[model samples]
Target: MDDVSWKTAVESRLDFLQRENLDLKAALKNILRENENIRSEFEAMKNILRKHVQDTDEKCNRNMKKSANKEIHTSVEDEFGIDPERDGQRVARIVPPSTSTISSIAFYSYLSKNSGPITAHHTLVYDVSHINRGNGYNKNDGIFIAPVSGVYVFHFSVCIGGSAYASFEILVNGEVIGAVNEESHTGMGYREGSNLVVTFANSGDHVFIRTQRSTIGYVFSNDMCKTSFSGWFLTN
Candidate 1:
């Protein structure tokens, strides 16, 4: 109502607004500082991840180079009867082969295929339901043919139901390399034996497993991790 009273009220209102403004500015500053801290932490994490990835890639490259170096041909001069220094030279660097050769093939069984209840004694061939890499194995004929000249590793598992006796021999090119047997069971749902052999093979050599000539039994091949046969070419 009075001029002096009006002026005093307006000044009081102005003082209150100035205090509120200062509070708002302080809040904004705190927000900006928090944002900067988060950004710095985020940048630090990104740098650490990048460094880990870089180290892993460098380690992989070093391992690959070391593996390649180990693949170089070593001469066996004593077996060939030529002087170690005379027949062929060993090279240090990795050289590309003149001819490309197929070197990898593997197969595994997944289901039941009967080996034999037919004759008193027979060679066992496995059934093929699943194959992993290559088809060097003939599931129909129960034989594996090498796809390249190399040392190969072969594994055969023989599982059988309640039976008198069972024995299997692993054969490479018609010669027995090794054998595995399961025998003398009074009560059995399933019994298994496995054999592994690492042997030299030329391209097109055949490999298989056969039951002993007098053992009258059958191999149980199934999806239940029973009888399965697998082989892979190791090196050429």
Candidate 2:
């Protein structure tokens, strides 16, 4: 072969190889662009998912804090004389006697006065009154005072002769608040007493007990105050 033919063949082969290299470089660039786009899309999706998870966690934490705060408030209100069932309002309170013993001179008495505007005072006497047999003794003398504004439970009891029958009742503002009946004796009369409970109106109410049957024996000392009927209050 001559020098001119050899030179032409070499140039043609070089041109074909250069074109193949150029095509390979273009394909590689396109693949790299597609890979970069896929990576960017994955990063964006991950950021969105992270943001949603963080938001959900924040919402749950807020709800839990609110519930805990409400429970704490309710407990505090109840401890401070506030009725949780009554929208955090103060209710009535019943104060019982320090001692629950009957003295020789047993008597329970209270003055009739409104405790709404004026502060009322009450006193009880534990006295034993002697009564003649076959003659009826009426020693129904006592006073009840309201301390706070709310419903109250009044309890009363009494004993008479060998057979004990008592009339226990409750009063609100000097009015009958519950059923009053003679409690008949079943077993040992001297040992047992009549028990009763009644609901009284809030504030300014009075309660007392009277003997329904005549007593041949002296008014004996019993729990409440003494020989006569006794009454007290308790808040419901």
Write the residue-wise lDDT of candidate 1 on 16-118 in tens digits: 9999999999999999999999999999999999999999999999989877654432334323323344456543334333255445466775336555553
Worst 10 residues of 1 by lDDT: 72-81
**For every candidate, C-alpha RMSD to the true structure in Å:** 20.8, 13.8
TM-score of 1: 0.55
Whole-model alpha-carbon lDDT for candidate 1: 0.71
Backbone clashes in candidate 1 total 0
Pick out the ten consecutive residues of candidate 2 with the lowest summed lDDT: 111-120
lDDT of each: 0.71, 0.47
lDDT of 1 at 112: 62
Show the colliding residue pairs in model 1: none
Candidate 2 yields a Cα-based lDDT of 0.47
- Candidate 2: where is the Cα deviation over 4 Å? 73-236
